[model samples]
Target: MSQIERGWDAIAQLDFDAALAIASRLLNNPHLDIRHQAYRMMGMANYRKRSVQQAIPYFEHAVQLVDNYKDRFSLCMCYALLGDMDRADRLFQNIDSLWGLPVECYVSIVMCYTEPKHFQRAVDLLEKIKLSYTLLGITDQTFLAIRGQLAFHYALDAVHYVLNMVSASFDTAKWIKSFAEEMDEEGKKSLALVSDQVCHTKGPFTINQPNSRLQYPLLCKIEDVSLFEEERILGIRVLYGKLHVG
Candidate 1:
């Protein structure tokens, strides 16, 4: 087998030191792909070993070799692991793809921060991702998977935060209304029951605490979801009053 293949085999065998040793040789390979792969392999090996700072230069070199979304995504995760969330988010936003591994990469970063101190940050990050998917018309299965992951990792509190945000957001509320309207009476009833359960389940955490103070632009963007919902409800109320007068 080629040295690269052998190196990957070593990695698969959990011999990170062996893999890194092989990666060192491949880093100077004449072939560009081999060189890039060497850097990435070193990064992954170090990342698996929790040597985040050591992993970063390898990922950074990989990105320097090929600055694609996937490369940037790898670097983003590395930054997230290093607790440089702002850098990670900036890199993620630069990646314009709406689906595929990019979404998975972003979710991986959020999931990495599932400790109690960082859990709210993860939830907030998930919320922003949900907003993106909502705007992009992503699948219900995707949404369900994300919600399930939140519940699995952080329990009901995280799920309830998402649910409450959905309850308040016009786009998500419209999704619920449209979905219910498409169903039979029994299905509608079932949805209502579930919605009631979700909406009523209060999260243990506050929305905007000191540590979770959102930055501008994105903060405004997130608030726009609620504001849009409020405006839509007000419009409905005005129309109802006019109809009653007529």
Candidate 2:
């Protein structure tokens, strides 16, 4: 493991600020690999702290050093953190319209577009993207790395719920009823677990530290989305979940 990765053990142990400090210095370490690894570690760290500003530079520098879709897509993440949907959208648009725009980045874009509430325009855009209404932004990759499409779908539904909450602030029952109506009989049965499914992530990575817990956003997985829910819900919570996992 590199220095940054080694320090990550300490950071994951709960030394947040200390981890940030080490990441800051090691990000520029003489070793190129260490530098990039440091940046990635810092990006994940900032993400955990919800400090989008701190993650930006690390992700930006990471973009400069790496050429693969993961790293480039990584930069779009900073845009999402900064709530700059325009830039994040544009970057994904420019990147060959590839299928793997990094699920992480896509989740962020959804968060920005669906924030506060869901507008018809947002719904239209989502439907367009989902049904291939235009297919203008499609791209092909060697293989599908669609790590958590379900997570994204569930997120959208949750956003619609939030929209209802915003539109009808005092009627929780009414809101749940309307939300439930949108669901099919089967999906309604799992509304309680919708969040549990969407919130939990399944992966093969492991690390030991005091703060490491299932609640870690890094552990949050994007499960299969329901036919009834919107992706916006997944976007908002997934972004938050990624932070905890980190």
Candidate 3:
């Protein structure tokens, strides 16, 4: 097997020292792909341990080889692990520069802070998004996400936060969905503008990412499963307007 494949094999086995040794050796490989892959192996292995600091350098190296959204998210997660939320915030703030990293970056920032019950800050960020969308105005805007026309992530995260603690009531989900729909054309244009700048591949940005979907118990999913009528009612009865306090 190629050294790169061997290195990855070791990493997949959770053999950090062996993986590191293999990675250090592959670092000197002539092929850029091999070099990049080595860094990913190193970074990913560390990430599996919930220790992002060690992942940072390897991901940074990957960026030096190919500056893209994927590498940036890897590095961004490292910063998040280090509790440098400003850096994390900044990365999302400038999504134009980090588009290909998939939707996780956007999702992760809000999740990292709010999932553990950081609602007020999440709300503040959403409000900021709303204000920005308003400032852009319809004519001046391009996409809703970027133009400050609407805060999709803001709304999405808020709904998610409220959802986890509350019962699987359509009322709560409906409220969150309505808030997203409230963004005016200008806001939508701004978001589109951001999307255009980030996604140049010409097509709707919708694809089933590989093992990348965040799992949530939305009412839609519950309904799809043919949840019994009583069970569904009970689910709705559970969480009226709750919060996670840790």
Taking all chains together, the TM-score of candidate 2 against the true structure is 0.47
TM-scores, all models, native as reference: 0.53, 0.47, 0.47
Q: lDDT tens string, model 1, 1-246?
A: 988888877766668799899999888888999999899888866765657678888888998997766556667766765556677767766764533443445455554443346567666666667766777789655665555444434433344455543433335445446444544564455445445445444444433334233211100001111212111111111000001110
Q: Alpha carbon lDDT of residue 243, candidate 3? A: 21
Q: Where is model 2 poorest over a 10-residue stretch in terms of lDDT? A: 140-149
Best-matching candidate per lDDT: 1
Backbone clashes under 3 angstroms, per model: 0, 23, 22
lDDT (Cα, 0-100) at 84 in candidate 3: 66
Best by TM-score: 1
lDDT of 2 by residue, 1-246 (tens): 755655576455545576677777886678888787777667656655666666767777776876556555555655654556577667766663665553433434553442423334344334334424224454321001121222223343333323321222243344335444545554455444443432232322222334222121112333222211111112333322233221
Ranking by TM-score: 1, 3, 2
Per-residue lDDT over 150-207 for candidate 3, one digit per residue giving the tens place of the 0 to 100 score: 2232332222233332333224333433433544454344333333322232222332
